[model samples]
Target: MKNNNNKLLNQETLCIHAGKAKGDHKGALTTPLYQTSTFVFDSAEQGAARFAGEEEGYIYTRLGNPTTRELELKVAALEKMEDAAATATGMAAVSGAVLSFVEAGDHVIVSHAIYGCSFALFSHQFKKFGIDVTFVDMANKEALTAALKPNTKLLFAETPINPNLVVLDLQMIGDFCQQHNILSVVDNTFLSPILQTPVDFGIDIIIHSATKFLNGHGDVVAGIIVSSKENIAVIKSTILKDIGGTISPHDAWLILRGLKTLSIRMERHCKSAQTVAEYLHQHPMVKEVFYPGLPSHQGHKYLNNQMRGAGGVIGFELNGDVNTGRKFINSMNLFSLAVSLGDAESLIQHPASMTHSPYTQEERLAAGISDGLIRVSIGLEHTDDIIADLAQAFAHIENVTGKA
Candidate 1:
């Protein structure tokens, strides 16, 4: 409800007040959606200027709208970027961000461990259009530099990568891309900009699946690309406009409402995840735990350096094989077994059978995801209650398999 210019408003304050216009509207606080396909201008000259991009104004929902602008500006502020562009879905943001600078013959360097859909889009879909890609360990600075080419247009990565939770060296990747004048695009959905900001590390662009953390509830589907106004103009004018992947104004409004509590929700999720991860690590039937928060995790220190705190997902391996993993997920009482992550209710799933099932066995192994591994999207529920549910499930697992 306030036109707060305080760009440095604490995240909590920004969540509630960042995009609001005060001194207007009968004291209603929330953003009202301008649910229209096209806006009418005052005069023919004004309409011409709006269409010509000579004067800044919303002409069509497909190009931009007030509700969508509120959400985009809020996210841009959250990620500490100059501007942002809202899109139809997470993949749309990914494709639009990279394809903005790349073309049929240009090259891209990507991490091996990443969202399956993103991998498919870059390595498979882009290849169909003659775009080239080199996949390597994004954490390995030497390998990342070596993977680059004279024609490489983008250095793409997802830190604490989807499902498996691999951490990439954002600073190194950012530096290398800068030296080559290439864009560094990061998928910040897992950690959200609240937990870790890739932009601060010099990443050229940041992408988020608002369907996940930003929504904080699984009701809306959306994505966003946050960068400077210059980059937004370049990307949206081409791939985003021609492809026609824009988020509806209503969905944008929902995302804005959800963002008001992002800081509150994330703190709970990460805190719950830490509790559960510790329990899993100490359990006898648990062979291994893969949460970045745990000190024993291989990437714990790297995570500490990059993120403000450990994230909300906890990944662990069971004593048995794929069937055991399925049984563990099915036997859980309190935690729902689902494919998607970053919801308000706790969810558990086996990557081998659910989210990453499309990957071959070798591919899963390469990503450090095993058939016995389970991932939990910790929610904003009572920690002790969550731990109790996991404890009961582990007890059953150990009774049947005689392992922790």
Candidate 2:
């Protein structure tokens, strides 16, 4: 773990070995989980020194834990960041990254389309604290520039945006933020570090909902923020320490285990998603398919530059109404009707009713989220089986609508 050869290793190898604890745990191959709530100190002076920032050691679970620290280090390495801080949930990572920098009277510019809870946190929660938020289509350079104010401190957005699969130009956004002296934070949950690393485009911070792609098993609820060590220290000391959004060591351990297969998992996810998107695009019952992997998608152009892969999610509108969309979703046997994504099992959800419900109908529509839009997370299942499931669902919709 203490090698300078990390840069020489491939991502697949780094996933397994990077940030591994220094010494073998009694010759065990895996990193030992430090599950205790508290650690023993040599003396009262040492404990005091640790708390007073005069020494380096764990003072409490809220402040730090060895297991969580390993996860943070691993994620930081994967993201090509100086450091990272683990959190209890993805929203914690989002809130911590934003709140650590801005205060009352400050302004933030966010992508018009984003996850529901994040939209709520910025639009509703921040307003109560006297913080101003401007929701703009980050894909539009002029609109993003027009929304900026003198007090705007940061820009937050998601690439292959949630429920819509809209990819943003990271380099453009990063350059804009730097020119304006504002920070840039991106939600890498959809693509994870395996498919996209925002830091490579000069982004200031990268955030992930480890609950999604990073965990890959859908069992853990966790998050991480990667940035400069200085920014991480600020976040850990502020929103993470004061607001108490620390991740448990057990969740951190699960994520560490999940990281080992990330490269392979993403490969399957991308390949499967591409096939699924293509099928949906050609289906007679589908009105439009939105996936970066498809040449028809507006975001597809970024595939050659910013994103390494199109990811596992796809969004499409049916040729019929809301009821038809509902029938299609309920008709699927293999794809689970669930809100979360990046699981082994294929999952589907309605963004208008499920994930983007936090946005009012008007807001959702304005952001390009239609009432009939259906989103799916293509899983590790065989492509034939996955397509068969979708075909049956479409057949159900056809039967119900008497169309196609």
Candidate 3:
């Protein structure tokens, strides 16, 4: 049974204890792994009744499964939503959430600087279908408000946006969207629901690329869209099923396993990332640092008022040329040069060349992802050792560049 008591419970408790289904399985500690692809039905009539919504039970693996439902329920509970749907990947969640609410003639407003794939999907792909999109600087609320169209069906935002660590004022964005009677979709991937809940700020829909922080270890790839039950039904029945972006039973099990440690893992990730960010801020070799927690950051007030912690990613620019980005990346001893973030081991990468390589020089500059900018996804390593590794790397970088 969905608990109306959900409103009173603290979010930290939900992470560990929400979405538990009791059955006659001899008191298991965790959700049982129902690894079967297809479930057996009592009779053809029963199966038909289940499909017709007369009774609630598993029919086909593609449609729904017990394991997938558990994951959905748990994520929905954590996100403070009525229901949720898990998808094959992060982009699948974004695409489904967007297309579910919009039509060929509708319009959307999205943050100008977003995930690279999302950028292409909105400006290039969705436009082909005649869905006009307005990319706005979410930091500048005045600009965002001026860009809103009468036919805007949705307003999208990502806080502490991937690699960039740019924070968005959730309440400000949500309020503006509500005034215009438009749905607000927030990508809570960077902070996760552990640190901030978008629903609390009146956000209509919350999306997560569960592959990263939700899973914690970078082993599984999944996405979740959480919203009110009424909206969820429209999404689940329409684009969600027809588009067919469902996660496998094994991946669902993996996500369930990952949720158990989300709280403690985030604590370490936040602590270590702040340590690294502070170290870089004081370094002469670094020109600028983009982290929400830093007082010098543009979104400091919004971040302070809204979020509990800064988060694991830190973006800084090298003081030299484009080759400086390469020197900084190649000089690292502990950090691995990788693309994806929110893993247990410290991974760093040159976003200009690695993550946002699809964008041209002008495009990258417009997004605030500079040529010499390097993004590091701080992981759950010993803080002192992580700092030591980066300090040595900076020393090595100074040797190569004759600065700092």
Candidate 4:
């Protein structure tokens, strides 16, 4: 592969060739994995120079690895950021980014609706450390304004928020953070860089659960944080270096391989999801559908301006009660009842009971995640088969409940 730093490549090209090793590993086509725990030094003086930061080299796997570095560089280039850090898991990216900058006395602002674990980490875990967090609906400008404080150090949000499919205005948040001189972090896990790049909107940091669309396969669990070179250096030296939330070289390598096909996989996911969402929107059994691809969706307005695509996830409500919804989920033969999205296998899950269980019922309702709402992650399956599977589930549920 040719390495050209002077020429800016498109996202599709970047996915396959960005940050690739240049004529290294005995001229191997693929980036070689450096799976060793630590690197050997030539002499004591050289080792001391490396430890002192006078020389550039890897000391230990936790500090850095060649394979992992490639993954970080690739993701950073994709997100159009200065640097990136790969973590053991998505939560690691979340916690590390915030903890590295904020102290116990500082306050933080977060999106009212986010992934269940992310909600827990901000609302519960941060509270334990005396770090006050205000959960405001980022869509509400007044609410966001009211939540800000002099002690606020960072603002965290997710676009096309998990399970609900609500889209927050990235430009608004970015402008707010810039005016306030506070760091802004966005969890780009839902759309990946293929559909949306948060950095384009002036977001200070971008985070991802590499376990999802980035990997495209339901195998390795990993996460990455992309940000400015200065911010990433701070996070790597503090949260990652001392706390040890580094990713395994093997997992990083797998993610690198997965990135090679991300563009095509995401294209298929979006195409199938749009069809599925349209189907659900017209179905008698579905009382409501939440997908940006549908004009009825509030997020539809942001389609062209804020996002390149509507992404693969869809949220909907059944006409019947919660039991009917459960039966609908269980009756599906093709869509597995599982958590996590952006996989090759289609998945169906209930937010109130599954991913968002960490939140209290009142909190879930306040955040607009209803008990009857069903979240589906559209996969790379044939569109006809995917719709047929959902069609059968709807038929089964309506037949048993006698309501449609």
After TM-score superposition, what is the CA distance of residue 368 in candidate 3 from its true location, in Å?
1.3
Off by over 4 Å in 4: 1-7
Q: Assess candidate 3 and give its TM-score to the true structure.
A: 0.96
Clashing pairs in 1: 284-404, 285-403, 285-404, 286-404
Model 3: which residue pairs collide? none
Ten-residue region with minimum lDDT total, candidate 4: 1-10
Candidate 4 C-alpha lDDT tens digits along 1-404: 45356137888888888887664499688889898999999999999999999999989999999899889988998898889999999999999999999989999999989999999999988978999999999999999999999899999999999989999999999999999998999999999998899888899999999999999899989999999999999999999999999899999999999999999998899999999999999998888999999999889999988999999999999998899999999998989899999899999999999999999999999999999999999998899999999989888987898876
Clashing pairs in 4: none
Segments in model 3 whose C-alpha atoms lie over 4 Å from true places: 1-8
lDDT of 2 at 220: 96
Model 3 lDDT at residue 314? 89
TM-score of each: 0.95, 0.98, 0.96, 0.98
lDDT of model 1, residue 233 = 89
lDDT of 3 by residue, 301-387 (tens): 775468878888889987888886787688778888887888898999888777777677888788788878888899988888888
Better of 1 and 4 by TM-score: 4
